[model samples]
Target: MRKSLISATAIMLFAAVIQSCNRKAETPMVHPDFETSYWIDIDLAEHPVRGYWRQVESLDPEEVSDSAGIANASRLLAEQYGANKLYVVYHRQFELDDARRIFIHWKTEGERNGLEIVPTVVLECYSEPSAMNFSDSTICDFASWCVENVNADEFGIYDVYIRQDEGSPQDTQMGILREAIGDKLVRIGLQPGEDLNSYCRSGVEDTWTAECQGLDNELWANPDSVDGTDLYGRKLLASWVAERADSAQSRRIVWNMIPVAWDYDKPVDDRGYVCPGDDALINDPPILGRIAKCHECIVEGYTDGMLTEKFGGYSCDLHILQANSAGHPDSISFYRQLRNGEPYTGYFASAMNQVSDLYKEIATFKQAKSKK
Candidate 1:
């Protein structure tokens, strides 16, 4: 009887171990926090608007067929992803005063998805043309002056692009520009020319030459090459601006300033889209890190009275999203639903839920650490 009992006990123990192993195998592994490290930098050239449209068409058939549809769809997608305003930067050939105002035509007017969406004008001002061969210090100083002297009430945000001159090192120029701007205002760096692969590629191969003349031309011609960094910066800045605008008792008024590549007379592409390649950058892990860094800077700058003195408290929510004009018709419809404030469905809904879960996990971790 004793021998039989021992064998039965061993068998039960073995079965328990096997069950434990199976349970472990069935459980999904928890991923590390996205904020832990910078992941891949987005390559815009790899994902174009046309490519997105193919996916969109599979999902929805009749959403985006013309320029108006494209514009409406873009705005809806932008808003659903947490964008407060849309802007198109106008860079002209002639040098305009820092205070000059050029009115671009209004975008498609109407209420879509029960939200009043009005597209605003974004004008670029150059202190000097590329021909002037301005030094780094000169450019920075001019940009600083332009930002400082601008009427905050009139303009929500200032999008300053320090033009890369011939023979100037892009990194050195950007560093100097940042230092010059200091905590007074935040500015983003843009790629200088048409060679998207030159700046977008990994390693030492990424280099930009100031061969491109006008900002508009460079952006329009090589929209694929435009760095995601710039778009991320713009999104970050816009979020803060939107938050401030929403506030009622706020003393300081912030405006949205965008650096755009504009061509008025140019007809819409065969795809019937305006600014075909000018989609907002995707907010992947690396881009999120960059956005966080920018947010930190803005917070510190505001606390130090570097950005403005009138506003006592300023905060922003960063929930930026990206969509391509070339996405499928279904994608366009999806955007419309999102813009209308409907609950996200399908993959987007699942993805957003995952993001929410991650945030909760991080919160729990922080709470536990605090108790310790």
Candidate 2:
């Protein structure tokens, strides 16, 4: 959570829960609270994105080029999970019927799922070229349309690769996004390996800053070997979290975790979907402890392999099911079948529910102590 999030967001969080109740209805729910934008859950600090709904799926260039398929999967996400945030990162242009699928169809499902669809548009950041910068108002228009049309919960930005004259690319984009989206959340998705201390230490004068800093933890976070003093491993991530928490307090940057793990062993060029069981993360108290330190954290979505039929790809769920049915030496198979007889989605929901409780316990304790 951002340092000031507690006092500022308590009311919004309450309103959102109320709004979520509308999911019982068939039509999409609009937030009548502030303006007419959809009521989005602001209890990021309170909600530890434990298992299921955390980047449920993403609209990337590599994903299967099927808008209808993606939309259907999104609908299932809402129908199955009820109300939870679906963190989707859009890196390419709205290809095919992507616009309707995302804004109209996806938004409808978003309401059903009680979504906080943080549309982090990384237009030029990716090689696919989202071409989002049609003009000064392109990104703004996109965001405005989401709120007014789709009634999207939140809008996030991953700064462009190119630099601006006044500020860095990210800083410039963040400003534009905030102005366009109005009071809706304007989260800044930070690049992987970004260090808060570097920004603090840089003598360069800067006036802009984002309240939250989202890190794409994925598989990069947990490494098999330690690299010098860098605390980046299954055993050392807790230390990294502790250090990051200290910086978060000073800078008031909300540590939002965005995971898409595809590597932890080989270098980037040689990476594969080899993660399984507890190899990527220890499903235990210590790992949960690390997660609690962050302001907001999402569960890893390496389950695409198992969900590829419904979703594009990763396999955290299959990995767990396999470990249980086939079994693993060092890990416990939590589920007996795919989603315990349901699907991969069900498995994630169950895992997140259990993990979320523990994370909240630690987060609540740590947050209270910090104020003292």
State which candidate has the highest lDDT: 2
Per-residue lDDT for 105 in model 2? 52
Each candidate's number of clashing pairs is 20, 13
Judged by whole-model lDDT over C-alpha atoms, candidate 2 comes out at 0.34
What does candidate 2 score in Cα RMSD to the true structure?
Answer: 17.1
lDDT of candidate 1 over 246-269, digit per residue (tens):
445433322211111122233244
User: Candidates' lDDT values, in order?
Assistant: 0.29, 0.34
**Given candidate 1, what's the lDDT at residue 264?**
24
Show model 2 residue runs off by greater than 4 Å: 1-71, 75-83, 95-101, 128-133, 151-153, 159-166, 183-185, 192-230, 234-236, 247-372
TM-score of each: 0.26, 0.42
Top TM-score hit: 2
How large is the C-alpha RMSD of every model relative to the true structure? 18.4, 17.1
**Candidate 2 structure quality by residue, lDDT tens digits, 1-372:** 585788678878988887866533323222121110111111111111211122212333222233444344454434442324443445433332454355565556556545545454443433232233334566677667767765545564443133323465545654666666665543343323344322221111110111011122333344333224333332233343334333434232223221112222333322222223333332221222333333232112112211112111110112222332232344333232212323333212344333344333433433444454
Query: Which portions of model 1 miss their true places by more than 4 Å?
Result: 1-173, 183-321, 324-326, 332-338
